[model samples]
Target: MSDAGKLRIDKWLWFARVVKTRSAAAALCEDGSVRLNGSRVDQAHKAVRIGDVVTVALTGRIKVLKVVSLAERRGPFSEAQHLYEDLSPEPPRFEPPSPVAEREAGSGRPTKSERRDLDRLRRPDD
Candidate 1:
């Protein structure tokens, strides 16, 4: 809060709660999964300032955010939300995944009938 102009991207990510930890954020950046202002950046020490746009390849989808302000520390979700403005593209339509065979915990291997059912699910031509 003292000076919002001198913040690093990795720190901002952690401060904004985009990642669970600063090390994780640094790793995300160092892996070339982060783009700053449309250019790929593979360094955790890159400086980020207000109004800069960052596009990141996250686990499930890519996210784009605009830096709105700097943060001094990792904070609550509500506080983190104030650090950046989300500009990510709308995600594609949801498609529920095919049902998977599930059994109770500690149930061990599938029973004969269950195996047959699973086999049928695996190969509809069966």
Candidate 2:
């Protein structure tokens, strides 16, 4: 933690375990995938302070996190979780519709005799 109560966004992200590596965090920032208080951030050196909202766009989801504190080093998962407050919305849930074709229980496949009986029913004695 800096005496000024500010840390570089990339370092903070890495310290908080937001990304696998610091370089990845810096690249994310440089790619404009990070937003500080709703403003786009394209630099990794940008300063981040407590109580600031940081929005990040990942591969398939967006994360909104509020900085709670600054970290001095990359720490354990439990410790890293305290560095920020997650504000991301819940992901949508999809429920598949029931199948249209329903089969009777214990009915495997029709026997050869069953097929002949069905065919005779359809021929109408002709």
lDDT of 2 by residue, 48-107 (tens): 999999999999889999999898889999989999999999977877867544447888
TM-score of 1: 0.74
Kindly list the per-residue Cα lDDT of model 1 for residues 1-126, writing each as its tens digit. 534566888998899888898999999998999999999889999999888999989999999999988887787899889888999999999999865766679989887998998889879985
What are the candidates' C-alpha RMSDs?
Answer: 5.9, 10.3
Model 1 regions more than 4 Å off: 97-126
- How does candidate 1 score on lDDT? 0.88
lDDT of model 2 at residue 109?
78
Off by over 4 Å in 2: 1-4, 95-126
Q: Count backbone clashes in candidate 2.
A: 0
